[model samples]
Target: MSTTQNSGRWPHEAPPAGQDRWSWRPQLLSELPLIRRELRRSLVADTSDAAAEQEEELHERLVLLMDELLSNALRHGRAPVAGLVRRTASSWLLVVSDAAATVPPHPDPDRDPARGGLGLRMVADLTTAYGWCSDGGRKHVWAVLAPA
Candidate 1:
């Protein structure tokens, strides 16, 4: 029940999204709900049945991935945190960027999962691929999402 229209491709398949994809520069944590809503609307506007389920599933995964990345960037990394979702014929790319460049992103499976520290692990399992790198003064943690 979303009004957003996909440029021909079912939200799940995500038509060729040129050079830059959906991008966001969230100023406060309070803006996350709005951002999530917009993303969900755009990706699930016209899906149905199995495809709908798949799109919904992928959308949920991306939400969690984005949440973890953004929160981590704000809590641990530096300022100017940004997020983007890119799509091609067969895959979706979720990227989170921040000014922090010293500490690299690591998923410590052995860490306790109660309070926290398990977000990255979840990202690894939920996404088709996951990695992070630092460029200039920015660090980007990216995940590849696809149906299993």
Candidate 2:
């Protein structure tokens, strides 16, 4: 709930106890393209020395993460009210809000892949850090990307 002011410390410091958190809400599947575009812009703006190639690579990774998050929301979040993706000065948070209260389970790396389910693990590997929380009647799954 506490406002994350410093860019470098986000995703590392837990939110302060009892503060209204800031969240972004996006609606409709069509809106995802726009969201992706905006995310790329934000990434570019936030990085001081990102090369064009590096930016392209980051953009691709962001798109993949976004796709995974969106797909997971649609498939598992159980009729999500809306999808929210938030960016702090230091981290990115992806939230898929559903009426369902259950949070996504963490991936078990040792489990046999034949059983399926690897999205969360991919997310963890791709991002700097990731976590989730459920409160105020919504569930949020999020990941943070380190500054380029």
Tell me, by lDDT, which candidate is best: 1
Worst 10 residues of 2 by lDDT: 1-10
Candidate 2 lDDT, 6-32, residue by residue in tens: 122223323222212233344456666
* Candidate 2, superposed: residue stretches over 4 Å from native: 1-51
Cα RMSD of predicted structure 1: 10.3
Can you list the residue pairs that collide in candidate 1?
none
35, model 1: CA deviation in Å?
A: 1.2
Per-candidate clash tally:
0, 1
Cand. 1 Cα-lDDT: 0.69
lDDT (10s digit) by residue, model 1, range 34-88: 8888878767863566688657777787777887778777777778999888875
- Taking all chains together, each candidate's TM-score versus the true structure is 0.78, 0.62
